[model samples]
Target: MQALEKRLKREVLQNGKVEILASSSWCVPVQSIDVTYQPVKRLKMDLLMKMTLLTFQQAEIANADELSELLLVEELFIQDLLRNLTGTGLIEKGEMYYHLTSKGMMQLENGIYEEEQEQETQQLLYSACHEVFLPVDIDQMDEYDELPDLFRYASEEPDGSLTFVEEELIEVLQNSREPEEEGEEQTVITEILSKETQQINDIPCLEFILYDRDKDLLFARVWNTLLSQWDDKLEKQLVEKEVVKWREYYLKA
Candidate 1:
């Protein structure tokens, strides 16, 4: 990864933008590029996985909707993540709810979750690289002056077209929008917020995009969105799951 980063920095010096074509196995043919990899924020997969485990620990029986709200991630993402966890025997799904498996509990307790998470991270990275041009925009930096991370996940439409949505990128664009003439700014904001939601298999998702203004580079991180729009019943369910404990705890306050 460090080698790739160095190569990308060199390429950025000569080109305003560079395109990355990753093989299905997530391998980038270095000979095909003036650079091998572009700079990006490190993936947060570990944090996300740990958070998911913690959520299950907190709520004994929870669905993707509940987990989405708890994690502030898109429902579709939660569902996909759950599926991956299930494959590792870290989680199990029955009907529409999910529970941590005994193996999962043991891994968390023994700090083995980190190792498992690393393996999963590698898989996700390879998946994101397959046959996609991950474009990184080189003219803008996120609010933190940091480049956004990249991941591979997309929703397929009925017509067979792929859609990628990035809530974080959208949020960054919205927050960083320059103030315009009164009504003009409002219009821009509205347009930004009105970005159509994308989904896969009817599951909500977003595409990832990374930008590095310092290097004048941009790339698409195509991934599922972390914005789940669940119904009120789901929220109520989460409340009920911990309402008694919440009440008892807050009552003293």
Candidate 2:
């Protein structure tokens, strides 16, 4: 505390152009959220699809109706299934026959299919004061006991929206996530379903009120303990430009 005060006095206010009027410990609000997402899953093929693909593997069916009678399956069902297989590029449908394509041959051997489902949830964070999402690991945060209450940033409800930075979310999701082994199916978060707020928390910070002696004005500079640096953006947006409103807040405080 003494070292910081002396440094601030020497480097920041040595010219006497600005004065450090007050300083206090601040609690910056943060919201913890569970983001539910639907990932692209690679699953084993169903029995029906396996049977259908196997049929194509054997030989092309000249007429599904005739084959259906011998196979004890409905004719219309076989036709629809063949059309679906063609749609998925697993089989090639000729004008009067069906055959397996190269891709279909691989699927027949692997017996794996791609699907998009199975909701997975991950915990993440949001900086309410900055109105942005963060990929910060919560376990690494350095917390402190209650202290001098200077200011407490208000918390915001996490809406069911994926409006945050896409890269940040991707980084968070990809961290510590990987395929277990070679030839293993990799799960990717292709769609974010929802973000539900689970808890509201606060990160402690050092907030200082600076008085501009020349202009007879007041502003704030906030130090983010988590990042161990000054929050210039929050200072600029929250208190720097709005001198009038923040001055009023200071007086009220």
Candidate 3:
């Protein structure tokens, strides 16, 4: 500090006035800059920039669904956030997850940053998925006994709804259907819901469930009539393992 003071005094005496630009005042315009002596301070926030940054920061560690939960914001907004944060290296994307970087961790830990409230709400849902099994609220057989009609339906019903995987199946079907059309082959979907039984709304129906064994994620759907075409070894594994549920078949990964 004393050396810096003496240098500044000497410069002032010599130049009469100090003009600092991108580097320290002592930096000569043509000289190489040595940032070793720079002071650390908080970043300045501009109003619009702050809003945009905060929006991205809230979604820093969120996947699509998680981002939706986090920001309760529109899909476009979340997409924008994903683009911004990934572009800036504040967060990283993976096949199935997003993660906050060290700088993000520091900002959160120091309480120097504030994110959207939706982030907290989505976090709760994310925690619930991590804690409880998918197809979580299985109406207890005994509990449903109070309503014999419901119990009877539950008994006849298979397990799982398979709602979440519907979109995935549709994408697959579309791709599979495209090439075959040029070859005079018709798009024939055998079945998506297993021949096994599944249940939805206490009713037995075509079985289907979306299960992610590694993540222990499950979403149940009854016969959407759309997934019947997705039945195959991969789809079968999803049901048999109970990693996904469609009727009687519980899929395991």
lDDT of 1 by residue, 1-253 (tens): 2343444345434544443322111211100111111111222236788778877877765577777887789989988988878886888877756777898888666544422221100001111223432222222211222223322222122322333344433433444435455431131211122223222112121221224456633333322212122123222433445446544543335
Q: What lDDT would each prediction earn against the true structure? A: 0.41, 0.68, 0.34
The digit string of per-residue lDDT tens for model 2 on 1-253 reads 4454455456556657887867766667667777777777666788878887777668667777866865789888888876777777788767866788887888789888755556888888778677766647577677565534434445444444325655567656766366456554656676667766666666766666788868877877777666567788667765645668756765565
All candidates in order of lDDT, best leading: 2, 1, 3
Which is the winner by lDDT between candidate 2 and candidate 3? 2
Off by over 4 Å in 3: 1-62, 112-253
Scored by TM-score, the top model is: 2
Error of 2 at 191 (Å): 2.2
Q: Which ten residues in a row have the lowest lDDT in candidate 1?
A: 118-127
Model 2: CA > 4 A from native: 1-17, 38-121, 147-188, 193-195, 212-218, 240-242, 245-253
Q: How many clashes show up per model?
A: 22, 0, 30
TM-score-superior candidate, 1 or 3: 1
